[model samples]
Target: MEWTLPQWGQLMTLFMIAIAMGMDAFSLGIGVGMRGILLRQAILVSITIGFFHTVMPLAGMVIGRVLGLFVEKIAVMVGGGLLIFLGVNMLYHARKQGEAGVLRDLASFWGIFLFSVSVSLDSLSAGLTLGLFEADTLLTMLLFGWMGMLMAGAGLLLGRRVGAWIGGYGEAVGGMILIGLGLRFLL
Candidate 1:
């Protein structure tokens, strides 16, 4: 397959995009792990994030196809907005000295699933953006999933070890990074 400019751009952007997208998972993982989540919890969290990274983009593609071009643009805008919102929310939460409400609530599968969906919404929309491109959806989703897993892994691994050194505040910083990246897409 002859790679178009967009596809090439997508390839170049994939890693950075993944890193940006993964920030949320990383941050949340850090917070969750620091609070003593186990190895099973970490694996499940990463898997859930990975699952959403795959599924959400496909859904985004479907929405883009059915919802028309204007809606597709709207999807990107919405995704960007959500990224910023989540980032700000994380920073705000940082000021508070308690655990994340989501972490407290995520004692079960359903709860984690919900969290994964919520965080992966950006990736879902990102998938839509990728879908809009004349690029390979499978490759894009795979890249996205791997990146998400990697980011989540970093978070969990770090969280387990020295998260307390920073009082587990890396998540807020990660959230800020995500917000910046999301805003960049809009611009």
Candidate 2:
């Protein structure tokens, strides 16, 4: 297939969307990394989160593709709402950190899985939106997965350096970023 200007635009759009979707994972990874994870553990956690980022969106696209025929309009709205809900939930958790249950260690299997799911929820919604628009599935998923992995790694490393200075505020900042992104999507 010949690459056209419109196709380039679509690719760029998908790349931006992938980065946006990965922001959640990156932000949350920062929050968790603040607790001081080792290098090996960081690698493991990032990989797991990246894997979920890919899987969740792929699953969403499959479901959304089927549903798109019936409720394309509704799917976009639902996607927006889901992003808002996830953002608000993260903010709530950040605000109530003391009252909230202790976060699980990312080094553990269950901990990694739970964290991965929490971060990847937004990707699912994004995939749904992409499907509603009938975007290229393979390219979208690949970008999402790749960006998620890189962003998570970067966040973890950054957090390790600055986490102590930020203290508990890391999560709050992360939550704010997510909330802003969600509102942007809605508007």
Give lDDT tens digits, candidate 1, residues 73-98.
47666656655775676577655635
Looking at candidate 2, the ten consecutive residues that score lowest on lDDT are: 163-172
lDDT of 2 by residue, 87-149 (tens): 576567656755654455776789888887877877887787667667788898899998898
The per-candidate count of clashes, in order, stands at: 0, 0
Pairs of residues at least 3 apart in sequence or in different chains that clash in candidate 1: none
TM-scores across all candidates?
A: 0.70, 0.76
State the TM-score for model 1. Answer: 0.70
* Global lDDT of each candidate: 0.68, 0.72
Alpha-carbon RMSD, each predicted model:
3.9, 3.6
Q: lDDT for model 2, please.
A: 0.72
For residue 22, model 2's alpha carbon misses the true position, in angstroms, by: 1.5
